[model samples]
Target: MSEVTERRAAGSPADQRLPLLQLLLVGFQHVLLMYGGAVAVPLIVGQAAGLSRDEIAFLINADLLVAGIATVVQSLGIGPVGIRMPVMMGASFAAVGSMVAMAGMPGVGIDGIFGATIAAGFFGMLIAPFMSRIVRFFPPLVTGTVITSIGMCLFPVAINWAGGGKGAAHFGALEYLFLSSLVLAAILLVNRFLKGFWTNVSVLIGMLLGYIVASAMGMVDLSGMDARPLFEVVTPLHFGAPSFHLAPVLSMCLVVLIIFVESTGMFLALGKITGDEICPKRLRRGLLCDATASFFAGFMNTFTHSSFAQNIGLVQMTGVRSRFVTVAAGGFLILLSLLPKAAYVVASIPPAVLGGAGIAMFGMVAASGIRILHEVDIVDRRNQLLVAVSIGMGMVPVVRPDFFAALPAWMEPITHSGIAMTAIWAVLLNLLFNILGERGRDALCGHH
Candidate 1:
């Protein structure tokens, strides 16, 4: 075996330990990378429900608390749960549109969304053991396509942040663009010139620099920071007891299925990157953790949880495969969740700064997909078409989110998610043009 492969097979550098100070700093970096995505679900749902600012703040806090717990469970493992990888758990974007729709429904509001999420979590837990049976469907062709699509879909969100968030009064301001560019340049320079741990935390360094620059220009407002509470407890059923309903439950169940598919791809991809064997048994543990996190999220007044793809890219970029890093990050998240003041401090980072880091981190995800595609028989026409068509379909939603606006509300979850849409197309196309076709040809020859 090659030296790199041998080291990967034996053990990832992720298993190595750094000093406690370095661990906390590096782990906190992971939390920062994923924080924007982690809180987005609650923000969307809270807004759709027309909740008060205090209520929305509560949602964000609750989400952080649950996400921290889930991340710990995933990295540390508890009984049958956790895949014992450098996996970071957070709210699934796949469920955001559906949750928002349910939030607006009559008599349903946030309660129904939570109810559905709880029901779906249990459903996922029950079905997780069977997920590995479908792993055969995801060769590099399918997984790579889906991963690429995921990156493409998120590009718009990054752009929006760089442009001063979606509804900013000065959206697309020159200042926003300049700050984002400065941070992005900073990250690239650090990664190029730095070595070891310094290189690994390049994104964090870039953001800090951007924050400083923004503060110097007086573009950052810290006045709101004064109003945040020092500490707060996330109470269960903060939105009241969830009222179970058929439609919302069914919608969340669909969301769970999508989360299952996405998590499977992530696990398989991580397995390849870390040089670990991804067997059915191992996948089951990961999926169970996904489900268990979502299940717990409901009780904690949060949304359905899944493994964050962004963090996977972080691991690949930094070459830090240690599960302990995320374990430390989970600890940080728990502290942030319980201490509103700290979370507010982190949350106060300008969107432009995050945008700068996001561009690099998200692009790494697409690059990882391309790296995997290198293993596939790309010369084959069938493989080429699968990659081409799946990416095109996935980009449709990212380019024109309203493309499915004419579709029924029930289709909201499926159509709005470019990742899920790409996944369905890639898997089915692979089966039709590759797996099933090969099986059919074998049967025909046998008959002869």
Candidate 2:
């Protein structure tokens, strides 16, 4: 094993402790970086679930609590359930689109939502052992394609936020650009001018400055902040409990499968980026962590939980590979979630502000993928098809989301997802063309 892998195998423990101020600051930086993404799933799902106003509000709170718990579990190893790498967990953006589709379904109400998510988590857990076998397939070539595709897929979402997000009548207006640019500029300026700890949270500092400026200009709104309670008891499966029928369970089963594949690639990407050798054991542990979080998120009234690539980008950029730092952040997130007012403070980040930072952070995730693939030897002509086919398949959902409209509603979870399609295609094709050899499939296996 490499030196990096050796160090990671012995993951950091939080007991060693740090200065109170420094630890608190790092934790806050993590919350700032991931708040938009963590809340997005609930915000979108709450609307689609036709939840009452108060219920919608609770959903957001639930998401925050669950996300914090998930991050802590992921960062600090728990049984077979953590990668012990510097991965930060949150509500997966991958599951968001499918959750929207599921919410719009006629019979699958919020109960169905819970049931499906729970089923998905279990299904994802069941497959971890099998999926870990495919880790070897993530050569540089494949990782690059997926990472680049990830960035490409997220680019529009970021751009939309930069323009004040979807449905803005004056989308792309100057005010929107000014705010986003200011935030972006703040991040850059901090990186350029600040030293030590401040430089580490350049993005967070920039965002705080933007929020202050926006508030002074009357762009920030806190009228409803005082109305929210500072504490709300989190009840598991608070929406009348999960009603697991055949179809919804089946629908989410596929969702979990896709999540597994996507996460495998992500873990591999992280391992490669950190110069850690991701063996089958490590991948096993990582996926186990995902499954636990997925299950936990379902019970807590949220969507799937997986590592966020954006924070991985932050790690790469900051060059701080300590899992201990993120564990501190996770504690902070949980504490904030416990305090409703504090959670609201984070929940109140304008989507547009998030959009600006999101663009930078999410784009960095995709970039990380590209870095992984750069090491692959793709010069051979045969390897080109692998990239071409996988990429083409991945772009389907991106290019035409409704392309599979005619497919059964149950199939929406997999068919409509470019990420899933790409993952399946890449894995299958690798086993086909790359593993079996060109024009020798039938010759060797005698089964074609």
Candidate 3:
């Protein structure tokens, strides 16, 4: 409901600078784009941490609430915390291993890990100023490779979704395809037939209609809603108190820093696509907010926070570049957090539908990265190799999760994450292979 200035940048796409009605549609589209990703972290982490189904459900709801608040900061922002650009915030996959490492169980557990996460999140926020230095380094080589690697790294998630989810009773079920087609059709049809608000809300409409169809066909589990309280307030330290083990905390801190690095690449891409200023100072502020949102996430018992990568596609598709739309999504996320019933309903979405959508969104991200590479000197085989090696490094874990299993446990945090590995490899290789290291360097800048 906040009124953003109607200032539009040159080269801003029609959808990027569309009217309010359209922006809302695009924004809601973003929520649907990332809802699956936002909830998955808690689901995975909770299961690994030995939480029961009920507990994991609570954790997922909590994660969404925190992520929504974080998205608001990432989009609207404060002194330094928000990117103040159009970006979606969600749980970072980078922290999944670190979270699994901490592995806080129900009772008689290591509470220090929880405390350490809180401490580490704030600590990451504090170091965000220094992290801004990375923006100078993402020139065409590094930026292009990292962005492409990001898409490459995430492609499996989509494929996994398409296959009817790992370990399903039957792979590639008809229900899954139908639900996915339903939502995807809802989105495409709305765009084709509706205008403004109706179009903007199409994703939601699709999801709603999809759930109704799924439910009527006996697909949804509404049991949780019946058992849920009328209102559930997410209390601080709702889980075990914070745990501050040096090893786990240190690992988590590293995860946070890596998240900032990946986010740097994403923020720049978004700014470039949206024609937002997002200069060094704005980048710093945006990163600061990301760290804080993540910090709060740990405090609230969740994982690291970063802009949702899926929303990048939504932004491209809808051209609603305004951050206000994300602001609205954030509010909805917060409300979902407070309402256990709403959370349960969202939790019922079949993996197949989510998988189908994931493929659509993540593929767009990969396409964006390749599009940026088109601006690079691909003729300079060095750039081609850069993309090759970087994407390969990213796929290390995906293709072989146990590739680094024999390595010391300390290395697990870094090795388990394809994105972090790919990012580190891309930046370093780009620095050594592409350009002479310079202080104010901007060679790795995304194709603008």
Best by lDDT: 1
**How many steric overlaps does candidate 1 have?**
2
Per-residue lDDT tens digits of candidate 3, residues 351-446?
A: 666665565556666777787778867786666787888889889998999999889876766788777787788888777775554522445444
lDDT of each candidate versus the true structure: 0.83, 0.72, 0.72
The per-residue C-alpha lDDT of model 2 at residue 296 equals 73
Query: TM per model?
Result: 0.93, 0.87, 0.87
lDDT ranking, high to low: 1, 2, 3
What's the true lDDT of residue 249 in model 1? 95
lDDT of 2 at 3: 34
The TM-score measured for candidate 1 stands at 0.93
For TM-score, candidate 1 versus 2, the one ahead is 1
What RMSD value applies to candidate 2? Answer: 4.3
* Cα RMSD (angstroms) for every candidate in the order listed: 3.9, 4.3, 3.7
Which residue segments of model 1 deviate by more than 4 Å? Answer: 1-9, 439-448
Tell me the tens digit of each residue's lDDT in model 2 across 1-448: 8433456466533222446676666667677777777877788888988898778878877777777777777767776777777777888766666677768878888877887788878888888888788776665666667766666666677788778878677998887788888888887777788787777677777778778876777666677888888788778978877877776677667767777777777777677666777788889888887877787777888778877756766665555566666787788777776787888777666656766776776677777866655555566565578778987888888788888889876666577666667767776776776666764443222122
| TM-score result, candidate 2 | 0.87
> What's the lDDT for residue 425 in model 3?
85
